[model samples]
Target: MPLAVYILGLGIFTQGTSEFMLSGLLPNIAHDLGVSIPDAGLLISAFAIGMVFGAPLLAVATLSWPRRTALVTLQAVFIAAHVAGALAPGYGLLFATRVISALAYAGFWGVAVATAVALVPANAKGKAVAIVASGLTLATIVGVPAGTVLSQFAGWRAAFWAVAALTLLSLICSVLAISAGHGATEEPRTIRAELRAMARPQLWLSYALTAFTFGAVIVTFSYMASLLTDVTNLSEGWVPGLLALFGVGGLLGMSIGGKAAETYPIRTLVLGTGVLVAASVLLAVLAENTAVTIVLVFVLGFAGYITNPILQARVFGIAPGAPTLVGATNTSAFNVGNTLAPALGGIAISAGFGYASIAWVGAALGTVALFGALWAGHLQYRTLRTSSVVAKGTAQEEDRATTHA
Candidate 1:
């Protein structure tokens, strides 16, 4: 793998920290902004909405731009958005900044995945993506917890300021590290061609898998702090450490998934989603047991992230026509899940089901994803079989013509 790939990861780390840190800071943000906790949680949904709308559009808009240039430009915008967020006067401005920052974040994610794939060997695409995605996991590990601590002491705004500074460092790293033409297309793709590529059913299935699998994770994770403090009887200080544990599990899961996906992409998806469903159900059942809850958090994180490399690689593998656009839409799909999961979780909380019910939501989504993965695999097999039959018929016709001649 190239140094450039890890640099993309560093960019993801900075951006991802901003993404997940909100989960931990929701209480502070809600109190300070005079909004209810659910309203603060809506900030997460707002960010997801931006990504859903921004990713594919941005990818198409920047279709002709060099990958490295797009990445650095997006990171710079993200940094600026965070600066605004840190200085935001009230909830409304801060909410607006979240959406703006997410647009840049989504654009960066799409380009970074494309660039990371372009930088590596054909056989190593999964590993390359995992390496880049590790930045997000590491953000969970280092950035989120650190932000939570900062938010705990100084203020939530302090965490945003730190994120802005770290993002600036990432932007500088990207400018210096990524080669000018690292992932540029020789000929720019037209809008029609990109749209045509996105019309494939198999590609859509991959998107569904991304949505459900990731949504399952967010359903529980979006309100994990409340669960820990309210149900598990853990002090607020323990949330960051436990969140770090989840990150550690994610790191391990991605490593395993990345390696396994090289030869067993569909199988990896099946296994990961299966584990997610089971873990989520079990977490729901045992939500009150502090020790079991802690263990399940790690399990849930591992299962949630393990499918990432596989699904991402699957999208690129299946959509050879417009790799960048497909990757962007895939990012959108994940955010769609992100957006819906939290909103649904909030509904569950408001409906008197309590925080533990979020795990059941996760379980349901993961089950849907598992079926989606199985269907995708079936479709892939049928496509391969049809191609083989057509090839054989073509060969026979050629032979008959040669004999006649």
Candidate 2:
């Protein structure tokens, strides 16, 4: 809503591109360095792993700092990592740099979400967070594709250099923006307290939903290039473009999800997730036709992204005490899905399953996730119903006693 948010979105865009650009550059990187493609692929995994670990860890560690300071510091770390990645001599150094960058990316987003929420009024918190998260999807539409092309045309090193420049700019904005009042201190939360908050069944279920959805998407997305070339009979040149198409859908879905979250989150999750399931089915069925595949892939991206904000907001509702921890852990859940999905997806493909089979697998996973979301809605309803009944009974008992007196 604010211009500051647009600046904040820049940081997110930079991080998102830094995180995913490698998918497009893997071949160039491996060939230049004389490494295997699968080995180079691990760099992407490393960044994700950093996000998974860095999210919760930094969220806890930075509890004492001003939100702005935390974000700036992490962005600095990301910038330094990118510089290192650009200058990295061998695969080992590059992989290590990704881990370092991940720490920053994870920490930056963790603080970014908290800062975004605090900046807004109570009524607008849902919308504010969605807008911030949308930066990640927006990166797909622009950042990653641009970086991919830059990596090829200018060399992979140039791509990292570009991301570094963006991160440095984010650091500048992080310093200039953010009001003192908004940066007011937060209550410290220890790991034990964080764990206690997560012990709630509803809280865990939300995380489970995050994990499942991420897994479903990542499994298909990791090998989406292969699918494009092998199943759809497209050129390697189309990989980044198709990926960007998915991001376009994600951007649209997230925008729609933000509005939907405002009116009725529960219904949104159930129905939005159902869309993802159906789109996955369409993608699987249409993978054979180039024209049809192009349309289905974008639809899948749109459907999958629309569900992100709802799942995120649900976690906050269930575990309000550890807000940062909850959000960070949910971020972790997304990466966990990323990690498991590709490995499993690859296994499915290797076992003689067609490339399209991965989409079917994702579709099946989406079906399960859709049902899980519905179950979460039911659980939420029952909890509220019980609380209302208890409150009403207490009021009646007090009324009767007052009359007797």
Candidate 2: worst-modelled 10 consecutive residues by lDDT: 181-190
Pairs in steric clash, model 1:
none
Candidate 1: tens digits of C-alpha lDDT, residues 51-83: 999999889888888887788788888988899
C-alpha lDDT of candidate 1 relative to the true structure: 0.88
lDDT of 1 at 343: 77
TM-score, per-candidate, Cα-based: 0.93, 0.95
Q: For residues 38-91, could you state the per-residue lDDT of candidate 2 as single tens digits?
A: 999999889888988999899988877777778888898888888988998899
Poorly placed runs, candidate 2 (over 4 Å): 187-195
Backbone clash count for every predicted candidate, in the order shown: 0, 0
Q: Which stretches of candidate 1 lie over 4 Å from their true place?
A: 30-38, 395-405
